[model samples]
Target: MLLLEGTFPFVAGGVSSWVNQIIRGFPEVRFGAIFLGSRPEDYGDMRYALPDNLVHLEATYLYEPQDNPPVMPVHAAPETMPMVECVHKLFETDMKHPDCAELFAGLMDEAGPDGKVSHEVFLYSPESWEFIKKSYRSRCTDPSFVDYFWTVRHMHTPFWRLREVAVRCPQARIYHAVSTGYAGILGVLLKHRNKRPFILSEHGIYVKERKIDLYQAQWLKDNRSVFERDPSRVSYFRQLWIRFFEHLGYVTYQAADDIVALYEANRQRQLLDGAPMERTSNIPNGIDIQRFAPLRAQRSALPPPVLCLIGRVVPIKDIKTFIRAMRTVTNHLPEAEAWIAGPEDESPEYANECRELAHQLGLGDKVKFLGFQKLTELLPKVGLVVLSSISEALPLVILEGYAAGVPTLSTDVGSCRQLVFGLPGEDEAIGASGQVVRIADPEALGQAALALLTNPQAWQHASEAAVKRVEKYYSQDMMFERYGALYEKNFKWQA
Candidate 1:
């Protein structure tokens, strides 16, 4: 069973693409998809179509409360008091403790191999809750222990309910997690309940990505008073989210049998967060290389002095830098044209800013915002592609550029150097497809863009090198083969 949270079939993002790829790659596996959403209403008009091999589709929303009444708060009963206390104690200490596993094992209800549901065993003993409340009060810096107790209850009461639901679900030999947020945590609980292996695949660092979004989020601001008074100057709710994500990382790392990341950078982060290095694998993002391969045949016809940048019209993409670079490039090559191709509707504010920058630089006519273009239709006519992102991780746009024999001018961040220019391969003079400059440096970016426009020989060499690199390393077949090996190894399947 694959547990997806607010991505996969519902959302359109890097993680969603990876999920679609994996399922399509292995049609033999009977996958039961368990989708977790923020609200029940959020499920409306989801576009992804399920494959034939997807035998079961189960949906659960995390933000929506469970139907059953709050079952008398686990602390109310004397008989179950000690079990609750033990769980509380386990939650207090760091997850790395050897004793934590014992506490987890105690709460599990052992199901026989015959697939029979066994008698319930209390894993979270009452004693666990008492110790947890005590620890919460002491470490939490709360003046009143009673207040801390309810705070913990209020925060994790839903999680406890989720755990209850997970332990009672139908059987699956393996549990697959899409992201390491709530769904990843559910994967941990499901593994514990079923005594089955869990596999966690991450397209993006869920905790880090979510932290970035939540740090800039506006909704969580209101809950600041309930949790703490001005806890960690950067939003109390943000800290709470960070802590929750940290706990999620701990649980998922501990429970998952195989943890896979999309790139080496992400894999390293996972290892630093306590995932065993031996269990981690880096399967870089792949594209339909063949679709762009035909562009190679038309490379000779591509318009010279044409520079194109394709991506979402957002602040992170930093289109202003590209526009500023065009101002300099236009000064050098009067015939040169710069095209910005992407959806303007994504971030109207950023789009407006870029438009203003273009006019302010007096290159408004020179630069064209060809909004939301199909790259295949546009790439054949473009000579160079630029990625002006301040932050990125193996952007698919770069790969698309590579396959089209279009060299990239990218900021040096998140595998950009590695992708465009792999480590010097046997003294080949540092196989650089294009230039990598520091982020937000318009002059340097302009110089790089200008140099490529004037020097036809250099541009030709870069394009050829890019094509060679894409064919050698970044092909879709290579990614599929690597992932197939990992899945088979973990699933214990024979050819």
Candidate 2:
């Protein structure tokens, strides 16, 4: 079973593409996926066709309005109060307690239908109300009790929904979560309920990404007045949300049997985020070289002055940075054009903003928004593949570009540095496949692109290095073999 949050069929590119590849790669294994999304309206039609091996696909929206049972007078059981207190303490300490695994297990049980503090009890009980009030008075720095009350309630509303999902989810010998947050928590619950091996493959650290979202989120209210607020410190509510995700990650880490990261640096991050070091390992993303190898022949002898960023035009990808870089790229190479080849419906506002920015910069015909083009068709025509993302986890596009004998220009984020420059020893000796620039630096990005596109020798060198690196290290067969071994090991344990 795959516990997927906002990825797979509903979304495309990045981790979703990798998930699709994994499912298709293992034609023999029967797979079930539980897709969790915020709301039905946020997504459109399925992004990828369902594979034959995918036996089941269940989707649940976390933020949909709930039809709760009518409110009734109730009190928490005496035993439940201790567990409740432990939960509060866990949140307070950011889930650093020695017995956090046991606490998390107990908390899951208490949320169960037969437990003393079930969803009904939590919503309608006087005990829950009193506890909220007590915590507000003791811990909350924000003046509004009303805001505090609603935030706490809203933050926890998903637990019941997840519990319900877990109870009804189809049985699988092993459970795997693509990312943490709600999906990770569900993985924990399913593991506790079924006693199955639970695996976590973190494409990027979910909590860190959530922290970025919370910091920029306009919906989360900051009740403090400008005079009362400290610009240096994060708002209490924002901090509260961050801690909430942190706790979720901690619990998931505690429950996972094997935690996989895309690279060594991310694996280390898993340890720092409370994952058991012994259980964590690295599994870099891989792609089909055979699929893209033929595209090399289709490329021009002289590389085109076209730069393409193949990803969703979302804020995280920093589409604006790519546009700004194009402004500089066009100044030197008058014929140069920037192609953003991904779906824009995911964030229409941001997409429109990027278009407007291009217009403002007078890059009228130089910039193109080629929405969701197939890489096979797109790669052969492009000169350079660019990644201006603020955050990424060993992006598959780079590997895909490499496989197509196209070099990359990416920001020094995630494993971009490792992918571009190569790992130490023989990997390092393969030579730099492309240039890595500072994140959000358009000037550097443009200069790097010009350096390669204008010089055939340099472009050819980078392209050769790219093809060599991907063929040697990142291949679908290599990735499949490793994952197949893991699946077999877990299946044997289950038997």
Candidate 1 lDDT, 1-495, residue by residue in tens: 888887667655445656777677778877788888777765555547888887887777766754533334232234344554555555655667655544554443322212111111222335545555656655654355555555555555446445655866677877888778778877877877667778888766777777767776766543335556653476434565677777667667777788988778889989887687877888887878888989778766433788888876777688998898888788888888889887576458779988988999888888899875777888888878888886777777778888988888898877788876785563144377887989988889889987876787888888878888777777778888887787677677321
Q: Residue-wise lDDT of candidate 2 within 79-100, one digit each (tens)?
A: 7777888877876765767667
Cα RMSDs of all predictions?
5.8, 1.3
Candidate 2 has an lDDT of: 0.91
Candidate 1 Cα misplacement greater than 4 A, ranges: 40-44, 47-50, 64-75, 78-93, 99-137, 140-170, 218-237, 300-309, 313-373, 424-430, 493-495
lDDT of 1 at 237: 42
Error (Å) of candidate 1 at residue 76 is 3.3
On the 0 to 100 scale, the lDDT of residue 100 in model 1 is: 57
- Candidate 1 lDDT score relative to the true structure: 0.72
TM-score of each: 0.77, 0.98
